[model samples]
Target: MNSPMFTRTSQQESAIQTNKVLRNTYALLSMTLLWSALVAGVSMAMNLPRPNIIIMLVGFYGLLFLTEKNRNNSMGLVFTFLFTGFLGYTTGPLIGAYVSADMGDLVVTALGGTALSFLAASAYALTTKRDLSMLGGLMLSLFVVLVVGMVASIFFQSPVLSLALSSLFIVFSTMAILMTTQGIIRGGETNYISATITLYVSIYNLFISLLSILGIMNDD
Candidate 1:
């Protein structure tokens, strides 16, 4: 029963809303990335040890839960920063170890690779007309597999398993970036906070995965 004009107007409004969410998500993501980097630098300077795995899991999941619960409010931003800062603190010790061992170039290479991958994935997502929502279920399945593999690697302490996990992470993170960006554009995701968190986590995983792969290669 809607007129053509009305339908057009609705589409325009939807597009505007989508654009706004995308802009806000990217802006907040940039700030959080900078904040996380600063926290990591401080942790490195202090030579802070990485927290135990149990503590790391509790902190990460707890903060993530809080952020999702507060996604509609201003507190979401606070929790987002806390979540990212916590991750930065965890990463600092790893980076410090690499630097201490004269593997600083590996970190730089991983960082560059991560950035390039993100940009390429994002650009493709934005331009592609294909629906990416179908990827959601597959991504979830991959995530479960990833978690199991990570736990197995922890107990077995196998370099081969670790390397395989790292490669899988790279694939998973790239797909995540593409899927998240397309979800934002297609109106599947409306909350900028949630969108930003997804992208940030993807980027973080990409960097960590690349770093792990590079480190393994260097060791051989």
Candidate 2:
């Protein structure tokens, strides 16, 4: 019953809305990244110890849940910051250890690599015409495999496994960036908050994975 003009207008409106969400998501992502870095700097300056694993996991998942639960409200922003800040705090001790061990350059290298990977992935996603929504299932499968590997590595204490997992993480994180960005552009992701979280998590994992790989290589 809709006229051609009406359909065109609806498409235009949807495009505008998608653009707005993408812009907002990037803005919020930048702020959260800066905030997280600042918190990490403070933690490093104080030489804070890494938090216990159980507490860190609990806090992370709990805040993530709260953020998702409140995604439609202003409270989601609050929870988002809380979640990222906690991650930053946890990252500080790891960075500090590297610096204290005179491996600061390794950290810088990892940072640079992570940034480049993200930019490459995002640019590809933006420019490509191919549909990436099909990657959803693949990404989820890889994530589950990674989680299992991580848990097994923890118990097995195998450096080879650790290195392999880090490599896989890099691949997973890059695909995640591509998939999430394409989703935003394709109108599959309407919530800026959720999009920001996904992108932030991708970037965070990319950085950590790069750091781990670099550290391992440097030690060898």
Candidate 3:
């Protein structure tokens, strides 16, 4: 049996640890995002060609796997940056295409929209401090549906359907941000490196999805 003083000390320690993890996660997230943005800018400036679909798939999955495997140590930090940088490089071609088409405003608008959505979702989760574990199953189901839709689009070559998938991805990313933030605040996520990676991926997807929708709408 624990004494009252011991219980209080334990609770305080837990809270401190949780706060530390949250702080570290956000700090690392900010740095990784800046790094990614720099790489994307360079890639865009050089007009770098996008990687082939197969290369993109393998690089993304491989880096993600490495990051997860090393997530408890400094190696996770290195892998996380590499993964985000790779994603940013892939994004450069799409952004360059939009710029070349004189749709730079669309890209800017998409960036603004992504920022706003992330802030809104994060704020709600942090302020309410509600448990979002229930969203886990729902998010997983939506992800499967999203993957299926994407595969179908590749085969069908339907612009209309591709646009629809972008819209769905935007929704999915929003929910992901909310659930991830809530998980951190509720002590469900302890590792800052893994949490940062998850949030970064959601943000990356959010930006890409928004950019796709904006480009399609502008083109139409």
Best by lDDT: 1
Q: lDDT per prediction?
A: 0.93, 0.93, 0.89
41-100 in candidate 3: lDDT tens per residue?
999999999999999999999999999999988899889999999998998888899889
Quote each prediction's TM-score. Answer: 0.97, 0.97, 0.97
lDDT of 1: 0.93
Residue-level lDDT of model 1, residues 39-103, one tens digit each, is 99999999999999899889999999999999999999999999999999999999999999999
| lDDT rank order | 1, 2, 3
Q: List the residue pairs that clash in candidate 3.
A: none
Better of 1 and 3 by lDDT: 1
By lDDT, is 1 or 2 better? 1
Better of 2 and 3 by lDDT: 2
- RMSD, each candidate, Å? 1.1, 1.1, 1.1
Cα error of candidate 1 at position 188, Å: 0.6
